[model samples]
Target: MNTIEVKNLNFYYGNFQALKDIGIAFQEKIITALIGPSGCGKSTLLRCLNRMNDLIEGVKISGEVDFKDKNIYSKNIDVVELRRHVGMVFQRPNPFPLSVFDNVVYGLKVHGVTQAFRLEEIVERSLKATGLWDEMKDKLNSIATELPLEQQQRLCMARLVAIEPEVILMDEPCSALDPIATAKIEELMFELKKKYTIVIVTHNMQQAARVSDCCGFMLLGELIEFGTTSKIFTSPDNQKTQDYITGRFG
Candidate 1:
């Protein structure tokens, strides 16, 4: 089933239109990758899924981004609560300058989950879910920023999972990691998709192909094509998608 749907979505940064009449549906408990060259609005559309664009001044958006059958752009929506259900992991590992335990419990603390036992339970479960518990259990008190790049990235994912979000948005989540680390994160993505609906904006076509069940190709602020990853990679109906996939042009 579809967890989120974008219909005729448009976005503008001041006078420049960033997303143009986009439409796509993200399925539940699966990985959906949006791939494109830089500045093609892939990130913009990712931000729109949880109203992250609202933070920017002079930005305008129209059309519907429906999460669980309700339009997220509707005036009645609570953006903070919306964000809780649709969490985001940025392009870089952005673990706060805090201890690993603190980072894992940060969102829960924000939402007023103060019971020590509950917090500990969540921390353990979240870290285990991201395959970090064995490595991090002894180091919960260690400063998060002091960890290796891969661990930090996994910690960031742990932080998000702690909040129990229904959908996770990852913006080039493995861009900063080495090949081995990237492979680990891709494996984690497979495990994560068994629980949360995942939407990733990736510049790496190969990464998208490896991790996503479905893929969308965007260019010049438009979604040129979207389909099953196998079809998009091997037999895309659109020439633009075929060209982009074949590296003829990006």
Candidate 2:
């Protein structure tokens, strides 16, 4: 079933339009990748899913972004609670400059999870979900920033999982990692998708093909085509999608 739906969506930055009348539905417990060249509004659309764009000054958005059948842009919605249900992971690993344990339990604490036992349970579960528990269990007290980039990225995912979000938004999540690390993260994505709806904005076409069940191709602030990953990569109906996929142009 669809977990989030966007209909007639438009977004602007001051005077310039960034997203043009976009429409798409993200299915639950699956990976959806948005792929395009730089500055095509893929990231802008990703931010819109959870109203992250509201943080920018002079930004305006219209149309409906429905999460669980409710329009997220509606005035009655609580941005904080919406964000809790739809968590985001940035392009880079952004672990807090705290201990590993602290980083994993940070969100839980923020939402009033004060019981020590509950926090510990979540920390263990989250780390294991991200495949970090075995490696990180002994180093819980170590500073998060001191870990390797791969571990830091995994820790960020663990942090998000700790909050038990229903949907996960990843913006170029593997851009900073090495090939081996990227592979590991892709494997983790597969595992995570069994429980959460995942939307990723990626510049890497191959990564999108390998990890996403469905894919959307965007260019110049418009989504040119969206379909199953197999169809989009092999037999796309749109010439633009075919060209982009074949590397004829991006």
Candidate 3:
């Protein structure tokens, strides 16, 4: 089942077009990776899914972005609730400057979850889901920024999980981590796909191949190709995809 679908989507920042007639569907409970060079609109397209671009000044969009079969850009749609359902993780760790416990429960608190016992339960469960429970259990009061970068990233994920988001959007989530930490994040993505739909914008071709079931290759402001990761890597139907994947050009 497709959880989200984009049709003839176009986005503009002021007078400059950032995306052009893009269309794609993200399968339910699977990982989809968008790969392209910097400034190719990969991240812009990712932000479109959750309407994150709305926060930018003078940003305009034309087209349909259907989430769970409803147009997200509709006048009656609640942007705040839309964002609650589609969580986003940025290129950097970006943990809140609060304690570990507060960071994990931040989302819950925002959404009006105030019971002490319930908050504790959510913190433990979210941390465990991201494989950070043991590491953070004894230091719940420590400042989130004081943790290692990798741990900070995991805490960000945990915060998202506490809110029970349906889709998780990651933009170069591992760009700041070491190889070992990157591997761990990749492993976590696999586990995450069993329950939540994931869409990632990544520059690392290998990471896309290893972690995503479906891959989309973007160039300039358009999607050049999208297909199963195996076919996209081994036998792409588009020359642009082949060139980008084979190191001919990006």
Each candidate's number of clashing pairs is: 0, 0, 0
Tens-place lDDT per residue, model 3, 1-250, is: 9999999999999999999999999999999999998889999999999999988999989999999999999899999999999999999999999999999999999999999999999999999999999998999999999999999999999999999999999999999999999999999999889989999999999999999999999999999999999999999999889899999876
lDDT of 1 by residue, 1-250 (tens): 9999999999999999999999999999999999999999999999999988888999998899999999999999999999999999988899999999999999999999999999999999999999999999999999999999999999999999999999999999999999999999999999999889999999999999999999999998999999999999999999989898899986
Off by over 4 Å in 2: none
Cα-based RMSD of candidate 1: 0.7
**TM-score of each model, in listed order:** 0.99, 0.99, 0.99
Native-to-model Cα distance after best TM-score fit, residue 10 in candidate 3, in Å = 0.4
Candidate 3 least-lDDT 10 residues: 241-250
Go through the candidates in order and give each one's C-alpha lDDT. Answer: 0.95, 0.96, 0.95
Error of 3 at 207 (Å): 0.2
Please give the RMSD to the true structure for each candidate, in Å.
0.7, 0.6, 0.6
List the lowest-lDDT window of 10 residues for candidate 1.
241-250
